[model samples]
Target chain A: MSGTVLTRTALGAVGVALGLYGAWLTLSRQTTAQIVSTVQYLVGGVVLNDVLIAAAALVVGVLVTRGLPAVVRAPVVVGAVVLGSTTLLAVPVLLSYGRKPDNLTLLDRDFVGGWWVFAGVVVACVAVAVVVRVRRGAGGSEPA
Target chain B: MTSTLPTQLPGPTPEHFTSRLRSPAVAARVGLWLGLSFGVCFLTGLLSHYAQNTSQPIPFPTSPSWGYRVTQGLHVITGTAAVPLLLVKLWTVYPRLFERPPSLRVRQLLVTGLERVSILALVASSIFMLVSGLTNTASWYVWHFGFRAAHYGVAWVAIGSLLVHIAVKLPVIREALLGDVDDTHSHDRATAVDQGVMSRRALLRTTWLASGTAVVLTAGATVPWLRTVSVFGIRSGDGPQGIPVNRTARAAGLGDDELGDSWRLTVTNGDQSVSLSRADLAGMTQRTETLPIACVEGWSANGDWTGVRMSDVLALVGADPESDVTVSSIQQNGPYYTVNTLQKNFTGDDRTLLALRLNGKELDPDHGYPCRLIAPNRPGVLQTKWLGSIEVQA
Candidate 1:
């Protein structure tokens, strides 16, 4: 076998083995409800990544790159990711998980307003980028 | 031109999405960020695990209360930063998932199968770790299994799979890094166009900027100075005495009405027992020390904790000041209530306090009302609050 293949196989085997053991330890100790919840969340994590997050990035990436001039494309994509990630992080806070009758100080922010303002900044930056790119005729050719 | 035409018999056809920008160079670049982020988080996570482990052969130190603060903060920061990097990394490599494996000798086929399985494991475990980790830091328990145990277990899986992945992709990563990023391979460039969109280099720059922005937006939970600007931070600078409260009195089912003047902190030394009320404990020489309560959730605040030292209290029961003592909470039951044990290092520290006051005011009910343990460099969860009793164990 090739060196790469040999190394891949050996390391892969050990990694997979250790991973399986950990999963077993975690699963065996959990109650049925916990196990089910664990499975659900694990699968949910995959779906959140492959389906929701990746799809959003690809779609928005394609849209900005395909529609905008080259100069604006990079800035807009960066803005989009900045907006997307910050929003994703801010969701739980926006949903107000920190707010409870028992605890007033946990979240204690106008997260909805904070997000809207943040979104506003991202959008404003993107808008300025589009204008600058258009004014400069930055694509160097007719945009495909 | 004829050679460029597709020439393979296909079964269960893979999805074909054409994009010239999704090249190995871009994937490797994003993978570098993903790997670094995960590496930092994993190492710091190990430190956090050791800090919380009650069975430490040597007791954890009770000084520089901000020690766990920095490590755990960096832990969450890098983990949070990885979210965007992971999404982008996966997106860059998504097309590879569809590429059919070339048929080969039986031995080669077996190796390929192992490689594919390892990749699958890596991807699945990484997703699980990032998602569950985020929820945990948010104090959201959407999963029923123990968060620490499961999170810790899956972390090993993620790190192990990461090693396998790096080993498998080392050559490709090396070549990608050595060559100019724009030097796309022939197959990838077949559909390439100079359409004036963002170049691969531009895309990488954007990914980096986005990650930096994410860190800036959320790191206020750790960097006290950044709290006002970090809109995404979980704990705003608004708790009593500017300290963030993880669990409240009401959340723990201990209300003002529940905690009456009749409450007493019972201390037992083998055959001997003593119960002291609030005034009795308060009247004792109140030593004041400033300590930070750093939680596993990645938020910490330093407060001037005023109360009696653990050693002085242990002295009351004629127990060795260096001995470990089990500290119990008044809350009926939960994972963190009655099982915490203060090690010799903690119990021996004159600064370690059964704090009766915070920032000079009488203890707020939410901040463990009557009393709470504030030790140096300990995870806040193990700093048992709502004092009930202490037992010196042999």
Candidate 2:
């Protein structure tokens, strides 16, 4: 009742949002095929990458719904927090990258479409995180 | 984690596998490709709006003979593939209508409601556009009610709808893309929870997985070597020119040199002082190019075009290379007019070859003949057949 936020759920949802935003920031600026290739290598496999993200996100969600952990959950959660947070800041730049091309004839909308998907994911995750953060505070930040 | 929430919601059963719900499946994934292909067409058209590349009195050539062909190819193939995709996607998403749809209370009402309405309109009109386009390409319409005008009109509807959909479904899209929202996936839910059973999370998860598969199939449909392993066997030989279409050439009332041996491409300047006949143009230098004519409407056919490049002819007449120009066709029955800039055309692109022949033969009257500028990679509207005169104006 303290807030419209998800209480413990806030910490967890925010974690997922951060991860999404991190991925978005990493991808939005890339024009050439290099980013896709890099992610393909970094994640090792596409399906594998999804699984990792899903597992991590779900674990964080569960952790947020539970009690707050400081020592273990803090550092990794902090890393994810940083990733998501950085994505938030990088969004405007990514947007401008797309918007600038709108007036120019040389740019393709496929690039814009690609950017939208990446950026949209980040923003969505942010919404979920904020909702949870306001409700319960940063209690269960760990899903490990 | 929640005391009130049940721990044993029934997981999505095997019945919910992709095949059981591929109707929308085909639409969404193929829609992405087809949609992007349309995007290419739309974008290329938009680019030409600023560049005025084709309208020039003289234009620089981009030199990749196949430059326009690739873009055109994507347009057609995406369109061809969409024929089946729209059918399937419509089927997949249709189930949403039967059940009492969920509420839109969570999101802002006006913005969200308008968006949802627009998306529905877009999806519907896109289907209309694609179907009408197919019919038009195949020449299936009976009464003929200004197909191009209607097509363009629907395009705005589709585009507008697309933007709204993007805005409204913004949340679900993120979670699907990010693969992280909540553990409310139908796969993960316990059997006891019934209230939240129709969770979007599960449908989206399925959609994403299915989307990946469809893209793979669509990509493989084009890849040559991959065709050897194609289990679905989706790819086709397309039309005679390796594009998609069924042209009844003989039925179209086309006859070889039907206009007779007296074929002349006359270039008349606005001043009317300088005019050149086909003979005069040929005397300077005649360039012949056998290039495939690709259109944004998603059809392609090859023909041999022989005549002086518009640039060369313009040069013979002392025309400026960089000025805007208009090429008009003698075929006045249809909307056979396009205005373009010189730089985009004759800039040594070699794409702007004037055609004198078709398939190692003389031009068929129905096809552009005597000489037509077979500018590659441009929409069907730009390739001016029966090219009459080149008028140079400021």
Highest DockQ: which candidate?
Answer: 1
Q: After superposition, how far is residue A79 of candidate 1 from its true place, in Å?
A: 1.8
lDDT of 2 by residue, A92-134 (tens): 2223332221122111123234345544654565456545655
- In the range B333-352, model 2's lDDT, one tens digit per residue, is 44324343334344345457
Among these predictions, the greatest lDDT belongs to 1
Best by TM-score: 1
Please give each candidate's TM-score: 0.91, 0.50
lDDT of model 2, residue B37? 54
Which window of 10 residues has the lowest lDDT sum in candidate 1 chain B? B4-13
TM-score of 1: 0.91
